[model samples]
Target: MSDGPTDLPAPREAPDAGPYWQAAREDRLVMQNCYGCGTYRFFPSLLCPECGSEEQVWGPCSGRGTIYSLTTVHRAPSPAFRKIVPYTVALIELEEGPRMMTNIVGEGRNEAAIGDAVEVCFEARGTDAKVPQFKLAGA
Candidate 1:
């Protein structure tokens, strides 16, 4: 199964996701920080869910988290994922308190477990291509 160096799907460029996408393209993980609510939000939203505030800033992430939940897809749901059968998808709880959906890569992808410590790494498929993925920390 292949989860790297392939024609992965291109991400949608929504207005609020501009900064996030730009950071990912450079192999950097970032999140929105709501100063009004003193909390962070993942997946990039224009409005803060904590206190319904729209004022925020882009903050860098440690890219370290624990696997809060996970699932292994033995059967590819779409053609883009066919080559990566048995891949692990995880809900990573970032150090900053926000959770995100992402894939586990490298050898860890095959053996990811709940509570496993992971660190973010970029998987670039081609020239000017980059996506954030994770691997078992110190594995």
Candidate 2:
């Protein structure tokens, strides 16, 4: 994870998402899988939406996905993001079937399009957290 600016707000860790954040801090991507129904989920829920099962497992992800949608931010929403105004934010559809919103970074980020393949990368947030970001596959 690169040392990002400290002006931006850091994400508050959710009680159910400690493992996920821990994995991110370790530079790994993981998803919650329902052991009862074999369904994968994101955003860390306590119960499985598919079967109402409380049993779930944290599993490593392939860290690969396709760009389901995207937009270029030509203006920063806040002063903290002013330095990176022309950045790309995309909804990535993971191979595990969950869609996660993240930034498209690295070379060719500005040219991202729907259906483009992407791979996960970690970026530093404040001092203690790492945010999962994406870049064009093999770029």
Candidate 3:
């Protein structure tokens, strides 16, 4: 019914995610780029995945991608997501080039397909709380 720790939300971002959030607040999808290896990264980390470099910078993304894979959750530990049973969560491969796992909102759960093109959208839960999500491309 649950994949991991549904009792808690995904790990909260460290203060280092500030720039990424700032870009999101402006409707921009920003990822991290390693200065040492020139690789695009996501989820905000201080080190490069390709290399062990600690120098990174924010990079803008195209907000276009295809669903690399997905899963529909039948149950949610939190009552808030109870009404959203069967919601699809996907791993998107961005055209600007990085894969980020996020929920696919505002679309029929059965509509998500592997390799289906999608676009970025933001769901703001509160005045200061927002999350990046995906939807059927051009939908």
Candidate 4:
């Protein structure tokens, strides 16, 4: 099984982050795209970092990336995460040119290698929670 808490703590949403999270709930991966500069930025913001434009748009992600960096957790950040010891925290370099931290999951969870190809897959929680997580490509 992919390592991590069975039920992740509910996400805390900020005003600027609403669209991103809403897209996730719909099982869609999106990034803040700068129309002026044609660059994508993460940790969503109203203004584009590259072009200083407030006219940014949410663009769909191919849900594809490469493992830029990673760590395998043998310990938990909190007692509630203890059950997920040995989970992976990775810096995924998305095809759109932004890197974000996310967990690596799937049958190859324990065998992730740097530079491994991955595709985004949604992890549904109960009824309304759908989180985009990375799995080995084609898994």
Write out the backbone clash pairs for model 2: none
lDDT of 1 by residue, 5-73 (tens): 787666556786778878988889989999898798976887898899999999999999999999988
Model 2 has an lDDT value of 0.87
Which candidate number has the best TM-score? 2
Candidate 1 deviant stretches above 4 angstroms: 1-4, 125-127
Cα-based TM-score, every candidate: 0.90, 0.92, 0.84, 0.91
Query: In model 3, which regions exceed 4 Å deviation?
Result: 1-11, 107-109
Estimate, for each residue in 1-139, the C-alpha lDDT of model 4 and write its tens digit.
3343466555566777877888988889998888888899997887888889887789998989999999998878787457667789899999999998888898887789899999997776544666678988987
lDDT by candidate, in order shown: 0.83, 0.87, 0.76, 0.82
Candidate 2 per-residue lDDT over residues 49-94, each given as its tens digit: 8899999999999999999999988888888777667778899999
Clashes of 2: 0
Task: Tell me which of candidates 1 and 4 scores higher on TM-score.
Answer: 4
RMSD of each: 1.7, 2.1, 4.9, 2.0
* TM-score (C-alpha) between model 1 and the true structure: 0.90
Candidate 2 wrong stretches, greater than 4 Å: 1-7
